[model samples]
Target: MQSDIDPRSLIGRKAFDRDGTKIGTVDEVYLDDATGEPEWAAVRTGLFGRDAFVPLAPSRVEGDALNVPFERALIRNAPDLGVGGHISPEQELQLYRHYGLPLPGPAPDAPGSGEAPGSSGSAA
Candidate 1:
């Protein structure tokens, strides 16, 4: 996500999957409570379709569209956390797990380690 772009601008923009498959239009933008950064977008898949949340970090905005680096089927099947209001930490963690993406915060097992639990803290 472009840091300069206003999160509100993402609303209503068309979103596409990795292979250019049309997924939906962004209905809402979820921001990180800690950093105020754009975190996820709830996209309405179709007319009367349920909103699906897509992470904003790995997604990009091109023209009037959002390009999500994920498969259409996977995104469409994401956990239905509903739209509006706040997303609790537990819900956020679930979203990360659903997308197989890294957690934004430090590893819980090793506080301040800034690395996932099985990492050696050295370059491979």
Candidate 2:
């Protein structure tokens, strides 16, 4: 598993393949809400084109460049965002739906549940 590295430090780092070809630069890191761990990285591909988000796990990070496990076809075929180069709210919703994560709402233990974090609340 990857350690909790600063996302800002990786923003402009080089992304590479197993063969060490220059792919692109890191754009942003997506965090898993439940774990606050990095789940994916948005990488810019193609000169002067839009970027795409690829699933990233801790094991993918190497000494300097990120070692993307999949082939270029998979990266090229991932979801495309416009030149704004950032994942938008709509895209996040789409990902959530695709992954079947519960939409954010009240905490499981609020006034109605009579429980709180660290207060005998049942784990969701």
Candidate 3:
């Protein structure tokens, strides 16, 4: 998985949005409890600079930076998961919901069920 990586490798890397807007720097990485894989990144953001967690699923490390497919406002507006603490499943769910990301795991239907969120499957 692209999300699986040495969390240490991400610290201090610049984070940008899909539109190439610089959001902030990576402050910390949160690991998934079930798999011990890098799941979210705590980014230092905003004028005063508070840490906000952003999902790493669709994110990619490019050169010296990480690019997340989310706007700065969206990450800033996500639930305040805090800069420290072991994120509980409940808290994780809240974060996912706030970001409109689906809960991790298999889809409820087949791939052709039109359940995918960001795809047209194939051009008609």
Candidate 4:
């Protein structure tokens, strides 16, 4: 029995643990590339201000509140995002490697404007 929820309304809502303890607010949501469906939510947690990626499957929206399946202890026990406030680029690469995701290339506007795809743009 799935409930109808407005995605726009969910933005900036408070997230709470199973015990009704405030964990954090929703930072950004990550979606599965193939299906473009929400997979996880980046939750801003801790005093130092870091974001933790939490599984979206175990979460539900009720009016203005987001209920997560785990307790505060469990959430805190999860791995830290590390320096620079969030996970580092190298760490992100490592995570993608661990998950077997294909590494993405630079954007269309990246340096070397007219170079061919996959070409580093130096005379060989």
Residue 95, candidate 1: how far off, in angstroms? Answer: 0.5
Report the CA-based lDDT of candidate 3 relative to the real structure. Answer: 0.75
The residue ranges of model 4 lying beyond 4 angstroms of the native Cα positions read: 1-9, 81-124
Instruction: List per-prediction Cα lDDT, in the order shown.
Output: 0.81, 0.57, 0.75, 0.56
Write one digit per residue (lDDT tens) for candidate 3, span 29-115. Answer: 877643467878888986697888888888999888899998888988888867666776667777888888876663466454443
On lDDT, the stronger of 3 and 4 is 3
Question: Which 10 consecutive positions of candidate 2 have the poorest summed lDDT?
Answer: 115-124
Ranking by TM-score: 1, 3, 2, 4
| Top lDDT hit | 1
Instruction: Looking at model 1, report the run of 10 residues with the lowest lDDT sum.
Output: 115-124
RMSD of 1: 7.5
Better candidate by lDDT, 1 or 2? 1
- Whole-model lDDT for model 4 versus the true structure? 0.56
Question: What does candidate 3 score on TM?
Answer: 0.79
Evaluated at residue 1, the lDDT of candidate 4 is 7
